[model samples]
Target: MQINVSTRHGHLSSESRARIVRKVEKLERYFERLTSIEVTVDLEHEESPTVDLRVSAEHKHDFVATGRASTLAASLDVAIGKLEQQLRKYKEKVQNRHRTSGRGAGEVPSLAEREAPDVDAEDEEI
Candidate 1:
């Protein structure tokens, strides 16, 4: 997956960028088709650091998560956790779609098929 890390209103050290890459790479285990990941770190305020994470996958909707904390690593961790939850939900939905696509081995009768006909037996006058 392609990873792009950028800092807004501040400078990020090389070590910090590497750490972010390592953490983001772990997401691939949840979703293999991930095409690209974008991480934006905003350090305008020294006390609070904000991290914006966006992940794109093949033939699927993109996932985005935002987190704010006292440190950059903490914020990244929070955002990553949110993204992991989204990926798991997406995986479950896709799996269920395939599982429900067709009928099972046994055929179940519908309500109309289960009901008896309403024909009257004593209709000799007709």
Candidate 2:
């Protein structure tokens, strides 16, 4: 998967960018079909930075999360956590969609196998 890290209102050092990329790459473990990841850091407010994480997966809408914290690392962590939960939930849904509805083979008889009661015989006996 491709990871693109971009910043807004500020610049990040090479070491910081590398660290962010490393941490973001771990998200692929949660969803193997991920196509790309985009990380955006907004430093408009020096004291509190906001991190926006967007993950793209095969045959799925983009998963997005935003986190604001005192530091860039903390914000990124928060965003990653949110994205992890989203990916997990989506993966579970996709897996479950293919499963049969908890019904075992021959547990219930088909309509054609059911016999109609003898109404005329019951009336004669009454």
Candidate 3:
């Protein structure tokens, strides 16, 4: 997946940038088909930093999470946790949908079998 990191009103240290990249890369374990991830860090105050994460996946809506904390890493951790929850929830929903959509194998009769019953009906009185 492609990850783009940007900072607003502050500069990101190389070490911090590397840490963010590593943490974001771990998200692939949750969703294999993720297409891209955008990370935006905004320093609105000297002590509090806000982190925004947007993750795009194939055949699914984007997942977004935002966090504010005293440290950039803390904010990022909170946002990543939120994203993981969303991914888990979405995966459950999709699995449940597919599971509930069809009858169990061998429970449904073929079209020709159903028609055979109708053909025998003409030999008896309704």
Candidate 4:
């Protein structure tokens, strides 16, 4: 996965940048098809540090998590935690949708069945 860490008002040290990479590597265990990881730390004048994370994967679903904290590392921790929850929820939703849509579809008679009319049902209705 590609990880880009950019600080808006302040510069991040090499150690901090490495920590960010390590923080994101945990996601690999959850989602193996990650395409890119973008982390932007915005330091506004007199405002708390805000970390915005945008993680993209091959599935075309984007997982975003934003957090503001007194410290950059704190903000990053919150953002990553939120992303973990999002990824799990996203996986569950996709799995459920596929399961429901692909299964139990052929069990019921469709509208076309009534339109064409089976001989027994047609005669009974008539």
Candidate RMSDs in Å, in order, are 6.2, 5.9, 6.1, 6.4
Clashes of 3: 0
Q: Give the whole-model CA lDDT for all candidates, comma-separated.
A: 0.92, 0.92, 0.90, 0.86
Better of 3 and 4 by TM-score: 3
Tens digits of lDDT, candidate 2, 1-126: 999999999999999899999999999889999999999999999899999999999986799999999998999999999999999999899887766467766788778658867679999998
Task: Please report the candidate that would top TM-score against the real structure.
Answer: 1
Pairs with backbone N, CA or C atoms under 3 Å apart (clashes), candidate 4: none
User: Any idea what lDDT model 4 has?
Assistant: 0.86
lDDT of 4 by residue, 1-126 (tens): 889898888888899899989998888777777899999988874257899999999968799999888888888899999999988887788778988785575787778886784689878888
After best superposition, candidate 2 residue 70: deviation in angstroms?
Answer: 0.5
Write candidate 3's Cα lDDT for 16-101 as tens digits.
98999999999988878899999999986769899999999998679999988898989999999999999988888888889768
Q: Give the lDDT of residue 79 in candidate 2.
A: 96
Instruction: Extract clashing residue pairs from model 3.
Output: none
Cα lDDT of model 1 by residue, 22-98, tens digit: 99999999978899999999999879899999999998679999999998889999999999999999988988889
What is the alpha-carbon lDDT of model 2 when measured against the actual structure? 0.92
Q: How many times do residue backbones clash in model 2?
A: 0
How high is the lDDT of residue 70 in model 1?
A: 90
What is the C-alpha RMSD, rounded to one decimal, of candidate 4?
6.4
Q: Return the TM-score for each candidate structure.
A: 0.81, 0.79, 0.79, 0.75
Q: How displaced is residue 28 in candidate 1, in Å?
A: 0.5
The residue pairs in collision within model 2 are none
